[model samples]
Target: MKYLLVREDEDGVEQLWGRCAGVDGLFVDPVPLPREVLTLRGCGPDGILGDVLAGPDVSLRSLGDLCVEVWDDEQPVQWWTLVDAVVVAHQPHAADPALYDIVLGAGVRKDESFVELSAPSRFELSGGTTAAAARPSRCSAVDGLFESRDDPAPVPMELIGCEAVEPLLVGTQQPRRWARDWAELLVLDRHGGVMASRVVGLAIDGARPSVLGDGLEDITLTDGGDGRPSPAVRPVWEKWCQGPPSEPNVWAAYDAQGRAEWLELSTRAWRVPAPRPDRSGGEYHVDGRFVTDVPGLHCAIAEALLGPGRYFGREWNAFEDCLAGGFGVIPPFTLIWHDSEVARRALEDGAKDAGERLPYFEGVVRLLERRGVTVLLR
Candidate 1:
């Protein structure tokens, strides 16, 4: 079954965040909702309906019995079929492992926190050691946003939900409300119109306010300027291309629309980690699992370094294809083996063939550095 993810702005204005196609978890393809839709969902002027929404303590068994009744404000009142699930996630700065336990208790296989782009930020392009020392190659098309800079921090947010069957409500801690990194989702009826939407603060208890990175705390960007590529950028890209092949790398060379086309190319070279003998089934690999056997610990490092989205193999021509597609010089993409175990196992298995693995990993670091991806070692 399909699901919609929703969140509110700092002003408490409820808005459409994103929609999950079935239950894949990553919220994508943002859309807008109408204000009138709020009234239909039984929301007051505040865009929330305590009268209609469920509570944080909703149990999984009760979902089948939950139904949302919406009425149009106009005389010929339209009847809308929508159900939401309310999740009042209790998140302290040091996240309780029990939260995951609770969600697992609710029957969700896996969950992750993500920052939906409500307000994208900008950073100045600089070489190094400056306030805005971001990787210059990543965001060439966008002007000032670079590759290596940190992911934008989470802003304050609230939760809003009613009841929907087959609903998976997984929540994560966010930064301050000022950061504007709250979670959001969009709703679409069976007919595919913006039916309804909601948003709310992600309640933070004993947590320190989150800040994504230091350096240029608030250095805004202006249009039109030329900064030479960082002294470290291309040699790294070339060095990896010259080295023995590892994971096939793909660049973020396509626009949001053309993404599928590039993705097809990347997937052709996509590498699935070692297979399980008992359960050999089709599974898209999580990029993080490439490094650590331990889930969550090294996954964050992999994602933080690689950036979000379903990443695949990198092609040198795909980088040019981005430029050809009118995306100015976009960031170069590279893939490397961050798995210490993989290297260690290779060494244990054999010395002669395994020798190149560590050096290959080193080249990956330099390559990722030039392209502006973060490398986190646990």
Candidate 2:
């Protein structure tokens, strides 16, 4: 059976809607509601409904059947859905030694299973070195603003408004290579402020966010050219593309003829260990068994590296064997590259000097595949 594996996170609900909305066939499951949602419900209407509805004069009451009804401004309205499913459970004994006891006991799996899927933090590396240097602290005030809790807090006035603002012309800028016809572009000033611009109708190139369109381009900039735009300017037009983030890495899916039809990227790093030798002179190698499922991506990466030529060498055989043996199911693969000209020269000369050089290249490709990484061998 085919499965659409969803890695759960804080924004998982939104991601579920974005990825599975209107899909032809697929089972959708969420591991569990966040702690905040659970606690909010427990705190009664004031917690779950927010303080806006529970001001000094507001009143609320919990209904008998796993539900809560709230009264705001002398009007009682709104109902909450509640289920008696297990919120948490612990199983001290199990056959699988690696399995943990902590579990969010939701219920029996039907078409979909709601399971929490978590990976190591970006600060935790397989190699034991703290990758935290590159990550922002979770305890920061900015992050705390969105932290989930057992109870919901009161809404601030700044976030509430009942007035509509007038539309304003922003400014113009350069077009991107993937802009399509009638695409909208939003320009941001140095202070992370958005400027308004609309694509009337014209053939443009490049994808969204980086898209360049014809028509009226709204540009926003400070009068002094200090690079920061006034916060007063906001986009009056709608965005054309609604894909995921494009930072850390971008993956484009291709058809049999090498035509790209889909693209995916991570806004953040996947955060795997760097493939390198330890003090013992032995490096952790990834199993290449997963390569078969991603032949197109493998080919794309190989072509990007070896340049239009199919990978031909003993390395290819090793890659195949690794896949056949299901090595990927174990330690997995990791991809790393060296930017030194000396390393490239060595690889070239080694390949020419001995037939064994092909194996080295294959090993690299194999590791990359196992780790779900598409290395852009430059």
Candidate 3:
């Protein structure tokens, strides 16, 4: 069958809405969420911007990991506005992650790119090193900020909100609250009579009872027969359509959109794992076999900690949230990433988040350590 669409009844139970041939956006990558760019007019940082002086030629610099603290009147606490490293107008060294624009004068939005700068600290960098020092292609590099010219003795720099920092995605993808004629079918679990659910995009049109979800012809509806997923993953889905395997790690063979569908189905099916066995701490092993891409990494991790087919997180934020207790295990636990050389060889390249890129495997390990998880990479 192309898909078996199911919906909840009046009693909050999902029932079969008949099978469907296909719909749109089912296997598509999620759209990036709109960026939340806050325009801070009067800005000031406590000793963060070491010695950046006001100048005509805008300085090009990089700040590694910055915790931009904003005061919240309602909450009366400092809010974290953290962004990755950057360069003003150019891509900085991978070591120097971000570049925040800092104008000398205090003003308002000149246009979409430039923001009003009052008084603020300017810092951008990556890998805890200045871009110029490592690369030396631009001006002489220092740790935090940099300038190309040797002007004069620095004055008391008047700072403003220079719109140099790249806005990160509010969420991984903007919430598509509504679905089109076709939606993804998620099988939550095998227990409880195979609990199932789907996005609310599917609806019956006119009186065509046979034509479900934009009408699936024999061609598109035929999984593995025709190559909707090309050939590499066709065999994988062909097996999946039969019924999700009771065993785990079915995600070993998928990537791109196909990888996404695997996560959706595996997330629901893998919830059968037992709760955190030890409240104090425990050992979780991440099998590195399928840990090639980002989604594959999540699949391996989820299966490692939660159990086969379980979902710890599809992305960094979700994984971070799961570390705050609940889910399955608590932090301060041991996470032995076995055969990690697989990830080392495979994930040497950077992984893109929002619009920025950072080291994939290292980022994951750093995150675990930051959350109090002991990572023993083998």
Candidate 4:
């Protein structure tokens, strides 16, 4: 029960999955059913016959061996094998050239035919003995128009029997205007399903932008008239630290006076461990943390300051998209402080023997400072 899965690429038949019973195959260009229909008929008892369709479980083995054979006007031109799936599979060269100039296409389901319009175009419909037809409708004003065969033409202004007359006041007057006022902000939950929390404008510094919940009340604004912090702010602070309120030691939220408003009592308070002195010889530790440690917190802060559409998750493709969109930095923040122990460990792990730590720390300090982030060298 061998089956062949053929997909169209820039060249004809970019991918092929062959020889399997009950196996699914993907086809980009519509498959001619003659070969498969004949094959199914030949399989009598135990040959190869069942449902044949592309599915998620379909596998592509020998990915490197697959090559594209392109033809120039019905003549074979060249054959090029992909270097790697990650590289070749997503390359712009894989797109079919013939589809580049396609503007419109139609789809028919049941008795109705739907004509899809792509770009700017005008269309007219005429009926009642094509030769002596009246202007049924003029759809030139529409940007993109489509109508069913049974839809009647819109009533024309002239048919209404109304005559145009100039107004007594010929001069243009200034339009009434209203002052822009602050509106209540909305926040959404992580799954984007429901409103998580809501806060007044004063609490979140006048409706700060946030990702977690819907409505202004859901966010932690700057302290409102009430001294106590907004309820939504506490959860946001905990989420940033990558620890819940129960984990007190790991995180803390302090007021302007440096008083602990909300605190987590976890032993691990966002600190990187010091480097071992014996193995690397005459070494010092740099205590700091990686941006990856509290990605949610970092992302939230960035969103608040820079607004939405700036940050990218750990996904490589998203990172590439950010780069393409002209974003110079990933996190887009200045490092205010770093643990000196973390830098020392990285150096100790990289060096063969003990060495002066000054030069290494200097380089680290320079790099961090250049990015407007403070590096606390302990």
lDDT (Cα, tens digit) per residue for candidate 3, span 330-354: 6888999988988877876434221
Ranking by TM-score: 3, 4, 1, 2
TM-scores, one per candidate: 0.17, 0.16, 0.47, 0.18
- Tens-digit lDDT track for model 4 on 1-378? 212112334565433311112111110122111110000011111100010111222122111111222233333233322222111111111244211111111221112223322432322222211110122211222211122323222111000111111110110011122112111212222323112211112111121212322321112223111122334345443353332232322222332111122212111121112212212112222224421222222232223222321232222123234323233233223433345454445443221111122323343345334444443444
- Runs of candidate 4 with Cα error greater than 4 angstroms are 1-92, 95-368, 371-376
lDDT values, one for every candidate: 0.26, 0.23, 0.44, 0.23
- lDDT tens per residue, model 1, 218-289: 111111011112223333223222322233332223222233332332232222222122211121222432
Clashes of each: 27, 19, 25, 42
Global fold similarity of model 4 (TM-score): 0.18
Worst ten in a row by lDDT for model 3: 163-172
Candidate 2: list runs displaced more than 4 Å: 1-98, 102-378
- Residue-by-residue lDDT tens digits, candidate 2, 1-378: 011112234564411101101111011122333321222111212111222122343222221112322223333233232333222323222444332222222112112213321321111101001111112111101111123235322111010111111111101123232222222222232233322221222222211221123321222111111111122211101110222222211222223222111111110111111212212212232222222222333333333322222221123333344334322122233233433232334333121111222323444444445545444343
> Model 3 shows how many backbone clashes?
25
How far residue 338's Cα lies from its native spot in candidate 4, in Å, is 5.0
Once superposed on the true structure, which residue ranges of model 3 sit more than 4 Å away at CA? 1-196, 201-204, 209-238, 241-244, 270-280, 352-358
